[model samples]
Target: MSHSTKNSHLSTTVANLKPSGIRRFFDLAANMDNVISLGVGEPDFVTPWNVIEASYHSLEQGYTAYTANAGMIELRQEISNYLKHRYFVDYNPDNQVIVTVGASQGIDLALRALINPGEEVIVIEPGFVSYAPAVTLAGGDPIIINTKPEHEFKLQPEQIEDAISEKTKAIILCSPNNPTGSVLTKEELIKIAAVIEKHDLIVLSDEIYAELTYDEDFTSFAFIKGMKERTILISGFSKAFAMTGWRLGYATGPREIIEAMVKIHQYTMMCAPTMAQHGALEALKNGQKSVLDMKKSYRQRRNFVVNSLKEMGLDCHLPGGAFYVFPSIKSTGLSSEEFAEQLLRKERVAVVPGNVFGSTGEGYIRCSYAASLKQLDEAMKRIKKFINEL
Candidate 1:
């Protein structure tokens, strides 16, 4: 079929959507040699041996078939136990949780199941790049709220209140946020919760980075008063357990919303991978030490990367969580994309342009410290050299 012929049947939403901004530099890096990449927001650690072994055991036991659309009861119960113990939140395994392909899928499912066409969802940016598009794909308009670094990237209550309109339906929030690595504090959560209560908004709380926090303990939106019934908690084993390739995640929320998402999941994804779910179950049961060990290593790398950036005269805030740092490259007289491109070209160091997250991200670049300390050291050297030359 010719291009125009193919275009005739394409959904306007999918066609007009821009490809992921992170992937643009990632693909560029793939074509280059000796490039040290700090661009991908992936854990460098392998899944723990016990988790992998459990998956192997599941396969050996002939458990490869599709799990219940909501996932295995054992797994859901385990998830329930884990959440209750870790975050002081209670969710019924039978009706309040659904295993998903990843947190990505959970986000999509939540938006798709809840959003009516032309409703608005508030998206805090520089956030995960997928948020706006996911909302748009679900037939909702996205209201972008540019969070300030000065506030450590926490969404201000005023901002939330200002963004609310008659059509506003939900707010997508990522704590221990991607790119910036800022975690919301309890006080901040209280402020946010008040606005949420007043506006009666649903919150899609992406807590994928909850375990990797360094500076403070994570507080789930569900744990706050009256918010549990209004929050969809999307998280997964990808970052915390180093199970990205396994594609396992889940969402826990009010039974009504969970049922809605599961309805969509049944017809679309059916269920998360059976093997991965089994592994995730093992992870919840036995992966605590491994998660702590990885978090320790990440904290060390975070320190090294932050110190290195300061030494090179690049301003970077000490990230409170996640394995990434957002540093200003504005002094180098380059746009985020230009700085990322030229850094890859000249120094063979791959980092993502911050503007890929939002227009407010234009003067910054996000570098993941998830790689080895040695790799980070070397990348820092190259980055310093490149900046000096500029």
Candidate 2:
């Protein structure tokens, strides 16, 4: 008998999962001296003082214990109000919302609550890294629908139609998408809405970057005539409010689905951190100006980074939203992984390999503009020098 079978009884699903391509690059750069990283898709901004102070105020008021399993009613109400005012989507705070430990936990809760074994969920790539793995871990099979660069990486209605099968249960949508920074236009989403209605599929819309759009206004999937009932709307303060460390996020959907996810969350997560929930409430209620300030800065950085890459002979799309620009490295005659690896090794400037998102991402690399212009300028110079040498 093999020693592995006898001694290590890990779940085969988890054991076989590939580690995150983004984190692998991050880890490699961590030990190196003076590596300028455009790898992780995280905000470089600190949480606004008012939001941080709110958490402190909560602690001062002895709000240390867990609140309701669905999270503090006040926080949920604020989320409800914000959703309504900002996106015109009304979700009942009392029954249709549950606070989570960041958008990631909300995503996992939704998948685990809904996915049955052998079911398939469609995940668009190059997309966020967590979508497919979360489905697999929930006992669902992931079906990748490769969104093409020429199409600006938006999931097309026809692609959705082609990928749907009897076993297909849901589709994940992220706009102002990570890795590519493409936002789905309202017209584009309407077409997807039609397909969703035809297939009777559930939609897990990751709108965590909802407030970070640079050009077009964001359209919530729930706003699509009849999507509210079939969509799990997940969002948070992490990006817009620069409250990533606060770890507060929330999900809104049909009451039944929200109830199911809340039940799982009650036993596992209990509630999002009490202080963080209070902080999130404050962000929803009073953080608009701060959000705008950060968005403006991100926009400037985006223009600079995108233009610089194009000038350096890299083909980069002007990202419509979010903070990343995915540029093709095909002309460099290097595979995406090879390009990212050699760039990091030679220039000490770390970027994530686009192939990590999926095979459609094979000839590109994702660069984040969340860093300061000085850092971006320095990194761009290094990248250009490296490419020129090649």
Candidate 3:
């Protein structure tokens, strides 16, 4: 179809939305040979055998039907218990939890439920590629806050206080952050909470990597004093449980906001997959060992990758959690995109350009340590060679 013809059928918001930069590099790598990809943020581990068996058993027991719009009560209750025990926060299973297709969907649902046209939502960078576009799609303007590398990429309280406006409705926060892998400490969160409470703004806290922290215990933003009632916590089994393909996640928050999200979910997704919900229930009940095991491996890989990048003279931070390392490519005298693309073509290594995450990321590149040590070692060698040749 011609561009004009396609534009006639597409809403301006949908048409204007930029495609995900991560996927673009993944596609380029897909068509190449012998490429070692450190681009995607997904875990390299398989789903735990127990979780898989539970899903299989659900199918055997004839549980293949659509679940309640909010999801199976048993699953929701398990999620509630897990959060309380792990994070010292509580949510009523009946009205305060909704199982989502993925944490990605939970983000979309939260924005659509809370935002009206022309309102603004604060988005920090370098952040997940989806945040700004998701806000735009939900009819909210995204007010960008660029956190500096000197601050360890953690959002500062002053940034939040300065960005507030009458049209500001909510803020999206992710930690251990995706591209940067920076986890916000409890003291830092308390400072941020002070700002949020002072402004009375709602927070959509994405804790999808909650179980993957290496250096410290993960702190739930909702657990901050006076924050639970105003924070929507979005998490899932994807990263920690290595169940990305299962497509299961959830959100817990104030009953009213969760109910509004459910209303939209019922008209759209209906419910998370019934089989996946059953699998996730098992994950919450008995998958702690698997979670810890994967966390151990990720911690090792994180150290190895960070050391490798630093050895090769790339300025890299020791990420506190998650499996990504954002290393500055500035000394190589190349833009983020040029460095990533040329490295892929010449060295057969695929890492995402940092600028795709946000403008503040322009001089850096994001490399995931989620690959095996064997693959990571080889990819690091290739990357070092690429830089040397440059």
Candidate 4:
């Protein structure tokens, strides 16, 4: 095929899509032998027996048909109730929630629904990689504001205020953040709330890790004063309940925004999996104790990995939540990508480079603790050897 002919059929939008840096690095690590990957942000535990049982039961009951575009009413109601019980936020199942294919889909739907062409949206740097591209795909421009390491990679009120303009349409707030694992405290969220409220901007709040807070209670943006009304709360069973493969997640917000999201959802994906919805509903009905169990283990693993990193001469933020430790690699005078690649290739320890997330991630690497303590110990040993050889 000629080069011009091969390119002629591609959508200009997708033709220009940059492949995910995370996936690119991951692919490299995957081919390497004897690699102990601490790179993926996924739980190592099996999905709880109860949740698995629920899915099986749903399948047995022949609940495999396509669900309503917004999702099953029962799951939506359960999600609404769970949010109120877990975060103390009022939500109407009928009008406030839409189940989707994991929190990723929820994020995409929110971006597509809320952003207008060429409008700018603010994303905190050293954050998740998906937010910017999703906004860009929606024909919106992404404005990234770098969060300071001194501030623990937090999105400051001043940063948000300074980033705002007449063209700004939305902002992404990820608490218990990926890569950094920092949780936004209530007071911190209140500061952000003030900024968004002042500008009347919509908030695409990704709280998928909401149930994994350590050292402090989880704070939902939906619970912040004046934020719930304007915030699209994206969450799922992935982090909290080890249900990543289930591909069930949801977003809750104003009815108008949700309806708009459903418009996109109906055209792209008719509905999330029916079996997953049923299982998710059962999870909402019976998964509280499981959440606590996982969180407890994660907290223990967090302490083990963070302390080991410090002992290995790495400066790491003692992240309050999520299952990751973002450690500085500046002393090695290596870029984050180089550090990650060298560690994986030489020491067989695979961690994600900070630069994979955003420019602010330049000198850090993210190590996920969502593995066994034994695995973590081995990973730490390999990492130590990798550092010592420098």
Candidate 5:
């Protein structure tokens, strides 16, 4: 049958969903050549060589078979230990953690496990694109709480409290946040923790960039007092380990919640790729050295791009973690979407429009500094020239 013939029953869920603004802009840039994309918020670094070697060894050792729905016990233990070592959070490997396809699926699973029709999920503005759609797909209302640049794009405890209503179900947080790259201070998280405690809200904390902190040690919501029972901590090897294609990530939370998520997982994914899990297990065990090295390179790029943007008169801040800097182009009196389009057309440089993140994300553009310094230098030169023209 033709697509049009079968398209009639397209679930309203899928039918009504608008494409991600980030991906729309990215798609527009994909066909153009001589283009530099700082848009995709991905590490340009290759997965470390040793991790690849381990994957080969695992397959050669005949380790290619389905694992448990939650994933291999040994791999789970490694993830548990890795969490303890890095974040001081303790979770039982057997019950608390579930190996996911990536932090991406972990987001979907958390939503699937929690949302009911019309229940509100509070999402931080200028947040990653995934949270809203995931919540919507699970039949939840996405309540956006816009955070401003003046506030460093950090969530205020008061704001959280205000957004909550009787129908509120959860709050999804990302920091070193994408687009903006803002890290929440411990004090800020502590404040938010109190509100969640008061409201008893489920917290889905996506901390995939936790290991990329530059200014201070990254803290986990999982480690926060009273959060263990209420928070679902989603993290993955993709960002920190430069293993984006590996498609391995995991979540730790209350057993009941995880068990519920695994029910969805069993039908949706069955199991994460066995070879990828093996690689992720290796990543947890020996990935730290590689993570640190990749982080070192990224830190340099962050400083280079952020500083260059400032020298060119863009209102940008040095972000605390992650490899992106969201710089304001408001002074130019153009919408971020317009600025981004012009930058690509005139300079052939691709950066995500901040408005794509949310309404409050307007007047700024998000550029990932995950590329080589050489590419960044060329891109910066083009950007400087482009801005000068305006």
Candidate 6:
């Protein structure tokens, strides 16, 4: 019953995991007055009205029960069709697709299903905070490949080749990546695919921000000629459809891998929420315009944030997609954590310290441009003032 005794009862894997740096700053901002948060990666838009109505309608029709383990057949078909139409990838809805609680769950499922004890999964860094830990919890050692700012944080094929070893089994990739907003182009992917093919490795491609790319066509890794069999495509309605609270996402890949993930899902999660599934169905059917409109707004915000940061002497990359801009704060001679904390305390503006994503992020901070233009303008002014005073 003692504190130390309780700690001993916890799994070493769970106990040793560091708390999310994003949430720590979010909590600090939550306790402060008049704080403008540019930390969280969630969209500022509400879910489309038709999606909301459909979810409510599902309940009225006495559909308040569990769906099939893989999800409703119609929703799966739509997911299949959407991918084929939008990104030119084909998946058999019957066995190749699974509706998940979120893309986060899809990541967890893929890792658990693919990894054996002591195997290694390559994780590209300045990446999602969950990735390395998820590999660890799945009993795989995470081999980190740190992408650099000089290269715009894009992962190179040589980097992948350098990290692979006899025990390496998989890799996690995010285009329009979280925190960095750096999108890998099709050419870049073709090169990375070569390395994956050479190693005969599986890839967990997180495309949650696929719809948010501003200046280029979004390419699915599975759409590449020979990569589909080795790629598990994970995506959701959270970013594009503005449905974060819905907690609905899905994955599609080779039937065998999907079957393995579904086996775990049935025992652990059973199925994704029924109403959220219904809402997601409506989103895929009628949410294109809303997605485009939101993408436009986010694109504008991305430009504003990048310009503002550069004007104030910060080194910022012009993000090609997603609602985040990772700007280097090293010029200010402050650590990422120190800059984030001081800005929150002095300017009442909340941003996440980039080091939490990985060591490569140590001198930067991630600022989400998902807020209203007015709020972004004000946050920029406060940030400028804070830098000037320092």
Structural similarity to truth (TM-score) of each candidate: 0.98, 0.98, 0.98, 0.97, 0.97, 0.98
lDDT of each: 0.94, 0.92, 0.95, 0.90, 0.90, 0.94
Better of 1 and 4 by TM-score: 1
Off by over 4 Å in 3: 1-7
Clashing pairs in 4: none
Candidate 4 global Cα RMSD: 1.8
Q: TM-score of model 1 relative to the true fold? A: 0.98
Give one digit per residue, the lDDT tens place, for model 4 in 187-270. Answer: 999988988899999999999999899888888998988888899999998989899999989999999999999999999999
Candidate 4 minimal-lDDT segment of 10 residues:
1-10
- The sequence of per-residue lDDT tens digits that candidate 5 reaches over residues 217-262 is 8889878889978999999988998899889999999999999989
lDDT (Cα) of model 2: 0.92
- Candidate 1, residue 72: Cα displacement in angstroms equals 0.4
Q: Arrange candidates by lDDT, highest first: which order? A: 3, 6, 1, 2, 5, 4
Alpha-carbon runs more than 4 Å astray in model 1: 1-7
In candidate 3, list every pair of residues with a backbone clash.
none
Model 5 segments beyond 4 Å from truth?
Answer: 1-7
lDDT string, candidate 1, 219-310, tens digits: 99889989999999999999999999999999999999999999999999898989999999999999999999999999999999999999
Give the per-residue lDDT of model 2 (tens digit) for 1-390: 332333568777777787787888888899899999998778899998898899999999999997999999999998999999999999899999999999999999999999999999999999888999999999999999999978888789999989999999999999989889999899999999999999999999999999999887999999999999999999998888988888889999999999999999988988889999988888888999999999999999999998899999999888888889999999999999899999999999999899998889999999988899999999999999999999
**Distance from true position, residue 171, model 6, in Å?**
0.5
Clashes of 5: 0
Report the alpha-carbon TM-score of model 2 versus the true structure: 0.98
User: Residue 109 of model 4: what lDDT?
Assistant: 95
lDDT of 3 at 357: 92
